[model samples]
Target: MPQMLLIVEPIGQRAERGRADGEAVYQRMLDFAAELQAEGLLLGVNSLGSAAKRLAKRDGGAQVWDGPFAEAKEMVGGYFLLDTEDEGVAMAWAERCPAAEWATVEIRGVGPCYM
Candidate 1:
């Protein structure tokens, strides 16, 4: 089966709302995940921490930068792995996501890889 990955991005007022309504948001996600699981559409789900780090190579050496405060338009807050046959259906699921009302849900098809 084809898989769709939903990447959740929260920015600006959305980010603030996520913090202010953390528990409610968490419950909403839980409910959404449960619905997907009941429909056999969800494979897995995870929420990311605010702490983030950037790895870079500067003049042949390694550099590490810490952030939850990067000057970026949005931060990746969570993700869901979904099993589905059609891209349109996967997109529809994303549209139904609770975060869709306040955040951006980016849908991407999972590609196959060979070793």
Candidate 2:
């Protein structure tokens, strides 16, 4: 099984931190990823940009919206996919994530939607 750690952060939080602070925080996350990789637990990782697009179908028509969306209070800042079968191990890793210090770290199991 695989687990995903989603980094959820408030909108504009990165900007508030400014470039220097943001880079420092990002370096911490990179270090964390390196540790996970060294432990053979990291499957993949990536930081997400706030710029996004939303698509929907309405009455057989395609609708597209570009963000920053007005209704969004939070955004997914990043994700870490870990190769693990134990949920406890995943939870433990989530607890150790650098993002947990300032953002929400959401743990999720990777599987088909029907499941």
Candidate 3:
């Protein structure tokens, strides 16, 4: 099994940090990723930009919307995919994540949607 660590952050949080602070925080994340890679636990990692698009099909029509969505209080800042079968190990890594200091590290198992 694989687990994903979603870095959920409040909207505008990055802007509040400003460029310098943001860069510093990002460096910390990179260092963390390197540690995971060294441990052979990291499968993939990426930081998400604020810009996003939402698409939906309704009534036989496709609708699309561009964000920053006003209704959303939080956004996914990044993700880390870990190769592991133990949920406990994933949870431990999530706790060690740099984002855990300023954001929510959501741990979710990789599985079929139907499951």
| Each model's total of backbone clashes | 0, 0, 0
Residue pair clashes in candidate 3: none
Q: Per-residue CA lDDT of candidate 1, range 55-114, in tens? A: 989899998888856587677888888888688888888888998876778887776665
lDDT per residue for candidate 3 within 3-83, as digits (tens), equals 999999999999999999999999999999999999999999999999999999999999999999999999999999999
lDDT score at residue 115, model 2, on the 0-100 scale: 84
lDDT of 3: 0.97
Candidate 1 wrong stretches, greater than 4 Å:
5-7, 11-15, 18-20, 57-60, 112-115
> Which residue segments of model 2 deviate by more than 4 Å?
none
Ten contiguous residues minimizing lDDT sum, candidate 2: 85-94
Sorted on TM-score, best first, the list reads 3, 2, 1
What's the lDDT for candidate 2? 0.96
* TM-scores for every candidate against the unseen true structure: 0.79, 0.97, 0.97
lDDT on C-alpha atoms for all candidate structures: 0.78, 0.96, 0.97
Residues 1-115 of candidate 2 have per-residue lDDT tens digits of 6999999999999999999999999999999999999999999999999999999998999999999999999999999999997889999999999999999999999988998
